[model samples]
Target: MNMNKREKIYLIAIIVLLGLLLAKSFYLDEYKPVTEDEILFREYVEKVIDDKFHGFFSRSKLIGYRIVSIKKVEDEGVSVIEVKSENEGEYKNAEIDGKYVAKIRKYLFHVLPYGEDKILSRK
Candidate 1:
């Protein structure tokens, strides 16, 4: 079929628009809410490590104190932390410091996108 000039132009425009929209959807990865639990869990790991390095962690002598577990808890404020201890079995009640929590927030929004893991990389 022979098409008019205007019709051909319109068809091209529609194709371009659809391609752009498709690319954007793939880039966005949908609306994923990280939730308070995920944030809290990440903060817990950073805090626990900080404490251990500063000599404030008492459970250092435990078996699994070196292993950091970051995950959202089923029933609790945000997420919970569980550290494996040698003789003590598992260490609980891992607390996150205010500074470390802020650091995690920065990392998630800014740093992770660029494949940077540093806390200040978000800037």
Candidate 2:
């Protein structure tokens, strides 16, 4: 292999860039031991999401709606939890396979979902 100053710099830059990207991804997907609060929060979110699919003539028609992933973000002085959910069921004889993103406010006693549910897919 022939060594050149410019080639060495470029190679080093590429390696550093790749290392940074790998670190960022691992940080973003960091895993932590599940706590009681996390479990409770997930359950609460599930109930809230399932209720959204209810209709006037239907009584708890939604089933298998689950919190697929959760991410926490801080804005201003408040902590907002972003939840991604996968829902599957039959609503009024229509097959539903849906994905949703819900923003929730973290509170002392309970977490409340705010804003409209962002539908990622419904088909």
Candidate topping lDDT: 2
Q: Candidate 2 lDDT, tens digit per residue, 29-106?
A: 222326543543454455556566555323433222324354332222322233344545422111122232334322
**TM-score of predicted structure 2:** 0.30
The sequence of per-residue lDDT tens digits that candidate 1 reaches over residues 29-56 is 2223265544544544555545544442
Cα shift from native, residue 115, model 1 (Å): 30
Candidate 1 residue spans exceeding 4 A from truth: 29-123
Off by over 4 Å in 2: 29-123
lDDT of 2 at 91: 24
Local distance difference test scores for all models: 0.39, 0.40
Clashes of each: 4, 0
TM-score of each: 0.28, 0.30
118: Cα error in model 2, Å: 8.2
